[model samples]
Target: MIFPEGGGRESHRKEEIKQYYRSFLWSLVFTVPVFLIAMIFMYIPGIKHALDTKLVNMLSIGAILRWVLSTPVQFIVGRRFYTGSYKALRHGSANMDVLIALGTNAAYFYSVYSVLRAASSTDFESTDFFETSSMLISFILLGKYLEVLAKGKTSDAIAKLMNLTPGTAILLTLDDEGNVISEEEIDSRLIQRNDVIKIVPGAKAASDGFVIWGQSHVNESMITGEARPVAKRKGDTVIGGTVNENGVLHIKATRVGSESALSQIVRLVESAQMAKAPVQKFADRISKYFVPLVIILSISTWLAWFLAGKFHGYPDSWIPKSMDSFQLALQFGISVMVIACPCALGLATPTAVMVGTGVGASQGILIKGGQALESAHKVNCLVFDKTGTLTIGKPVVVNTRLLKNMVLRDFYELIAAAEVNSEHPLAKAIVEYAKKFREDEENPMWPEAQDFQSITGHGVKAIVRNKEVIVGNKSLMLEHNIPISIDAEEMLAETEGMAQTGILVSIDREVTGVLAISDPLKPGAHEVISILKSMKVRSIMVTGDNSGTANSIAKEVGIETVIAEAKPEQKAEKVKELQAAGYIVAMVGDGINDSPALVAADVGMAIGAGTDIAIEAADIVLMKSNLEDVITAIDLSRKTFSRIRLNYIWALGYNLLGIPIAGGVLFPGTGFRLPPWIAGAAMAASSVSVVVCSLLLKNYRRPKMLEHLDIGGIKIE
Candidate 1:
């Protein structure tokens, strides 16, 4: 049930592997005898005497025996190639199948004609090529078997993710009083939204939810790449497929089925594998005309060598001791056709992309596929959001100064009750700080606030117990015509100078107090900026806070460019301006109100803890919510493209050198000629080498500078 949106079955996969094995087995069973009959017996004197004896006129027994064994291999065991070639040619495009089918068919039909002509003549000596056609098909099938096996390893990460879901879970049916009425064991897939599930020690949580009862340490290393166990308590969200270490806990399902994080990851990896990079077009353009060009070159090679031999252009000894000038020319033509492979060129980019994306997923970096990887490698600048992105995102009340003669506890009660309705980080910080004054810590009830309002980029407004209370920045107070005292202005100035957001509390159009809230910089914030500078990337900070507070925070983090007091839409404008300046910009944000900016950048990287819209718009998701992952995403892309370049070099270089030698280009002077079967084997090996070269990316580790970095409060080993 944890299977992705598009369902698949193991039965179908098993059948496909079986089909490949069967084809290879059948080719081997028929091809071995044909090779032995045409090659081995010719060297044995007794068998050579019997092979030389003609059956019907000039036709020998060895030729008839090879013809019977090779016929089935040519027609039956190698039928897939003929079908592939037909499909390719019908679409007006040539592929690897066309070259393979053309080479094997020429050798098979020509040997058949040679046998028929020899039977009709008086003293005709014909060299039948049954071994050549049959062995070529056999070697190609063996190569395919190896290629499929190697390709399966590319999806090992997805398979591991799917297998992490547990089979069953303990379901609990609760009453209106929050008491468990019934408990039963059920399949994990049957869990629905809002359904409470019990997780015991040594069991994985059924789905993503928050715990309503009990506490335990859950190990989430498999999903988020955090190497430690996280403590989960009441009202704390827990992810699916994580192990529960101790203590019995009950979690209500918030997201189930494909909507869970595990399923989303699987879908992302699958999409990445399907999306093609712009660099792949280079190989695609070459493969379209590769076969037809090779066919024309092969025909021209045959005619050149045949006319040379007819007019005695080279020494006669250059021909093999077993055959005449005609056979030498035919050998060169068939070798040329088989050696040039289009498969190698076609596999160069895709295989490397697949391995690179898979390696990224294993390290908790989810890339959106080839297009993202292509853009990320060239990113020279990163735009960072201030609050949640650059800092810990959790603001706390640091200092409070009252301008009016009001009780501190009574003022805070009014402030917390008004700010409780707002979702801004600063509002939440005020509410949390106010909770310290209440004696009822577990469930403190505050006075009801009427007509609550949140002003974007400013603050909030509400009415508490007939008292009109306003909590916001100086702009909100001035906009409402609330006069600010000189003492209040001084307090606000001091708060901004200290890198803290200053909140003005006004009651009945009079400035009452000033509350300074400070959000600490995240661990390694300066180091992140320093490492990005070393990588030749510029760092900029953008925020909705005032210039004084934003500049103070930016200076502490070593950021030279700072944009402050901007609305959500204005953030997107800055991204567009930077992009227009010829910089490949990447926007890193918490996916909150800055979604427009995330969509505008060349590459948008969203933190996993961000809003759903931000994750949807981003090209890469930092699942661990760590700033260091931005560096990992960029470095991974540069390395993957480098590997892709190496693959292309090897694939093209093999074809350039192989095709010429197979055409007997070195034979006339050095008497060194490549046989047709050996050329066929080399062609198959070239394609396999390209795939194997890409598979090496699985061993990729993050850059040395990014190693041993802490993520989500866990010190990874």
Candidate 2:
């Protein structure tokens, strides 16, 4: 298991990765000479003659050389395994550390016994296996070094996000009127909320806040995945870490430090990696008892082999002629212990999860945890909220027609004044549309409206320039007893039939004009829906809008299933109904009302939540709100889970097949035997292969959804 002890900071993890690599280097330095003396020099005729000659008074030169070389590797470089194994055993558990310490220590102690016997009797045949113990420690340390390196690559996304924040910021000293009077450069960590800062051209914003002084194009592609730099002006909110590309901007810090966008994203990704998935829990359970059970099997195999060797009188030549029954039994036991260690089983899930979550973060898809990544692969039904999810959330005035003989300037000024104070989307569209008409005038101003009242879901009414002005839909106009002529009514009906919102402007109880407003569908929305359909995913649109408007928008986007006029709670109920019918549902939405349905679905996907990294109910957040990311997310999850399955098969197969062979299963039939050094090499190779397999996910690319056309300047073909 990977331990994130320093709260997921990249520097802390780098230190840990380096520490393992350093330890591995030291182990190899000592183990190589020990290996040559114990395995190579003893087999060479000339070198064996020199080593067999007495160099010292009591000990042979070979015995003294092997002891000096192997002692440091067992006690110094291999000390962590002993301490880790002891701690785990004290807590009534056994892990990979326990298996390593047991296997290597057993081999080391047996070699020490052989060295002592050789010193006592000059003719005692030396059977020192110090090479087995030293090589086992060296191989395991090498596997650990590579594992640490692979794990670090999985957190590269978080590191890149932290690097986006500037080290220093230009803090501004403002006058009483909030105008900048002076500026000083200070560390970014010293910044607080409400502190005004200057962001010059090509500099990153210090914190999340609104632009207070200048205007510029800010590149938010790091968080939103949009390639274009967004236009930022005074009063426009800018996220911290976004760059001011072309203009100098003065911004006040609204959210600093932990509340910044970059900080939240890093925190969320770290938490996602640390949380265990359901399958991960199952793997943990199996590994918890896996080591101890392997120990028992190793002991059982040793006893069975020893009893068979004694009764059969060494009839099989599988046992070496020079070795006794006990030495042969010890060899098989050491092999079994080294081969059955559960390092690969421990690595099967987390390495894959870390790499998968990191890949999702780079694409602006924030998955909350491994459980979400696991569950996302099985989603077959997708439910989408209509307003901000399928169509552009902002409404625009499409066309306006005059219904009364009134001054055009006067009509625009009155409507703009009445609706300017309204916060509704349609009202804001109208206020923005009227501003363009006044560009020719030198100083065109809107008269302040009095006694203003906004009718929710209807429109606004106010007294503008001593005239009673009311701007609303047909229902609001009829509620106030305003008479509409046949021509105006026909115009309103025509716009509504085309899935547009009709706003009626009435001055002094007389209908003056009808404004056609519509929330247009987003670009490439139709193509994305078609792509999902071709991928065999069922798409459904759920909204509180009228059936006519909802169906009209759905039909244009190739969505056949429409749940129109459904309230927030009703949307969640619809999701539950689908889930009960044996379909895995993925709900996608952006508004607060969609939170309930987002939580009710199998996987809740929040769209366009660029700076809001902590979307409460969403399992996955698509920062750009692009429909293309929805397909990318599903494709990535499927591929990631598929990689995980392959890893499990390899890990389980390696242990099952390796343990028996190391226990001398083929000796009786094929006259073949496994060696302790070979067993250690196989164990190390198995763990390294599992980590290498997970690293392959870093190269995963989202499948091309629209291969025939260009979307966002990326040609899929």
Pick the lDDT winner.
1
Candidate 2 per-residue lDDT over residues 441-535, each given as its tens digit = 64456899999998754679999999999998776788899998898888877886898866789999999999887898978888888888888
Error of 2 at 100 (Å): 1.1
What TM-score would candidate 2 get against the native? 0.86
Per-candidate TM-scores read 0.94, 0.86
Error of 1 at 265 (Å): 0.9
The lDDT of each candidate is 0.87, 0.83
Candidate 2 lDDT trough over 10 residues, lowest sum: 1-10
Best by TM-score: 1
| lDDT for each residue of candidate 1 in 628-697, tens digit (9 for 90 to 100) | 8899899999998998899899899988998889888798778988878888899889888989998999
Query: Which 10-residue window of candidate 1 scores lowest in summed lDDT?
Result: 4-13
lDDT of 1: 0.87
RMSD of every candidate to native, in Å, equals: 2.5, 4.6
